[model samples]
Target: MSAATLVGSEAPLAQTHDVALVDLDGVAYQGHLPIDHAASSLGAARDGGMRLVFVTNNASREPEDVAAQLSGLDIPTSPDEVMTAAQACAALLATRLEPGAKVLVVGGKGLVTAVERAGFVVVRSADDAPDAVAQGFSPDLGWGDLAEAAYAVAGGAWHVASNRDLSLPTARGFAPGNGSLVAAVVSATGVEPDSAGKPSPTMYRMAVDRLDARRPLVIGDRLDTDLAGARSGGYPGLHVLTGVSSARDAVLAPPGLRPSYLGADLRALLEPHPAPQRADGGWWRCGDRAARVVGDGLEVDRQGPQGIDVVRAACAAAWAAADAGSGPAPQGVADLSA
Candidate 1:
């Protein structure tokens, strides 16, 4: 189907877009647990002829493993429908390194296999004198693993991180993610790593090109990584309030981090997005709901349909204010999400 060039549309995204580049963790599931509406919502999007591509920053798991987990959660995903940061990292390394260059993989099986598949020789330690160091997250990684990565990177090896997500969501709470561990290596080596994950736009563009998506909507919960990547790649993004970011975050987002559309959850794919329009008196309106920024605070007036309209109006109003040299203060944004 030929997709329209429109970003925020009156028609359902399922009908307008050919592909949905979905973020897995907070959008589809929270760790090992399934989301309440995610399975059915994504299934409906698929049935409506939108191809689903599950994009993840987690370099620990393989596509097949992630697919199996989503399938078990009733999402009915295939390995081909999944894209991981591990694969993206490998691709990034391939562009810089020779065909058989040695990469000291300081990650789990997924990252190691991805580097090997990209025609790089995978090594274990700095003692191997590898050409590069690929760092990612693994639950079993001990002090030895960090030391090895630090040693290799300090020895003039190119350091590459799969994703710079500072925290990982688990069933219990947030823990150290790949970025946290990468920081340890950075502390020792005094070197920064080139990432091939979200916020880079490399992974997003790679997924779009691989999937051959003409109109791909980058959907995620984070404003920094997902929406920022979409902005850089010239793709429209739909931000859902399902994970780390909240409705208030969208309102105060800078130009690069702002999403094209806002949704409460995955089911937003099935609905129309009515963008907030500029109204009189420095306000933005979406379906009768209105919002505006007053000094450092934000005001929401004229209530409308519950969930999404408020976010839309708030974002438009706040964005306008910020662009004009006035943004919202933290004290005022707390109630939008609540």
Candidate 2:
């Protein structure tokens, strides 16, 4: 069935106001190459009087490095506006540890520096068991290092992980993330760590604190990390099918991973004075267009690009209808199993 038919009974809370837009990327730039759509969406977010932050789960790089990456992407972002799980892990440790606390940081210099910046004494594997081992993402982790991490955790140090992403997307493909390292420790020491990445309240708390956000909306490409995170934090999430998520995957999200709003890209929400259309047997207005569902899917003949923008219009209409308590027939979009 169509997306509208999926949202059968329960009405989705509608948001007609500005929303906080967060970009999940290590850097907006890669050497001389700029991240596609980074500049435009970020610029649009700023112009719309919306809060914008780059929330990256890549704990391999420090905030400064992330800033430099944005500089490369030609996306202008301040250091304060950048939030990394590496930084969040550090902050969590600092608040709970004593001054001069010994930390066994596994991962990269980013985690090390963040821990040190948080007033914790940094320790490596060569040193004695530290007070904690902050596991962050490291691409070149050695097998021996996994043993070392196990030893650190078994030695009675607190285990903290930057993120639990089993794999991270790269220019090549999916690679192991910091969660892989944390898994080693868990397997060896029988200990699970406190995570500071997506889907964790710790990461959300850090982001909300940094942005001073109130009634903020989570925007992410992944349902597990982004939508689950928002649900865990009791906030609404906007799922944009622009990154790793496929249309089929989105149609089959688990209950906890469902997004309040679904769209194809960032432009659907960031554009100023967009159009409205009739879609999914309903009407939606964004900027100047109306979207309605004509069949199993949305039908938008508006004067703009087809894709995520069109999907956004349809989603907006559905959301509006839901809020008005007169939206589509609820069929649990999560059951689509695309």
Candidate 3:
């Protein structure tokens, strides 16, 4: 996890996760689940509406793979809707590097392939590190290989890290990520590499430019990468609890690290003007909102606009419905509600 500095430490005047009403296709989307709603929002925006691009800092996977992963989570997304730091490196070098310039890699195939596809020739540097070590979740790394990379970086090879996340979570537990490996190189070489992940304007510029999107909104799970990245890019970020950062992080979050909006998942804003009403009957009344047993599936217009309360009630409903063995929430609420 990124240590908390003053929020907006990098960009003092940038808006943190301050959220507000935004319209798409003549309807209002609560904008809490930005990542979940990204694809549909972009599509709807274009058809006489608006657009958004999901700039993700997680660099282990390419754009297509990331989109596929999100899809499995029931997030409606497209390859064009996702941009990873791996892809950013490719886009960054595209304009700066000479065609097919020799480059050394320090991450995984995602980063390597991104560079190669960008027309750079990736060569193992004279520095002895295994070129690059793919470290994330369960990294198959050896001390000798890391020692080699340390030597190579000390020897003057340019080092590129796919991301700077300290750990990635899995079914098992937290594990070291590329950021830890890059630390070895930094320690040996006294050279800080240009991080290609979140909070790096280089990565955000790539995704924003790719979609030619203006006034775009960013969405993701981690406050360190996603919210900070949005701050760097002068955009708003929506934080969701399904992934990395948790409710505790939001409450204790330093200023810059807080999200503009928060949601249980992408489904929070699928409907417009969701209101929770308890009637005398066993059935309650919720209109212009999606429902499930998990959270109140119930909408409270009064949840504080900022921080995790931003969507706590929604989460409560979803969690409740889930315990009741509810099937997927009502479908056909217009795919854009995510």
Leading candidate by lDDT: 1
Q: Report lDDT per candidate.
A: 0.86, 0.65, 0.50
Per-residue CA lDDT of model 3 for 17-77, tens digit only, reads: 1221121111112112334444453344334343444555455556676566555544445
Can you give the TM-score per candidate against the true fold?
Answer: 0.96, 0.74, 0.61
- lDDT-better candidate, 1 vs 2: 1
Ranking by TM-score: 1, 2, 3
Candidate 2: segments with Cα more than 4 A from true spot = 1-21, 26-35, 271-338
Off by over 4 Å in 3: 1-54, 71-78, 94-96, 127-138, 271-338
In angstroms, the error of model 3 at 290 is 25
lDDT of 1 at 213: 88
Q: Residue 188 of candidate 2: its Cα lDDT?
A: 84
Clash pairs detected, candidate 1: none
User: Which lDDT tens digits does candidate 2 get at residues 31-93?
Assistant: 245545657866765665776667777787877877776756667777777788888888878
- Candidate 1 local lDDT, 1-338, one digit each (tens): 11111136889988888999999878999989987789999999999899989888989888899999999999998898898999999999988999899999988888988999999999898999999999889998989999998998889999999999999778788898899999999999999999999888887777788888888888998988887888888888888898888887788788888788788998899999896788889888887688899989899884545567877888888888877888778787755752
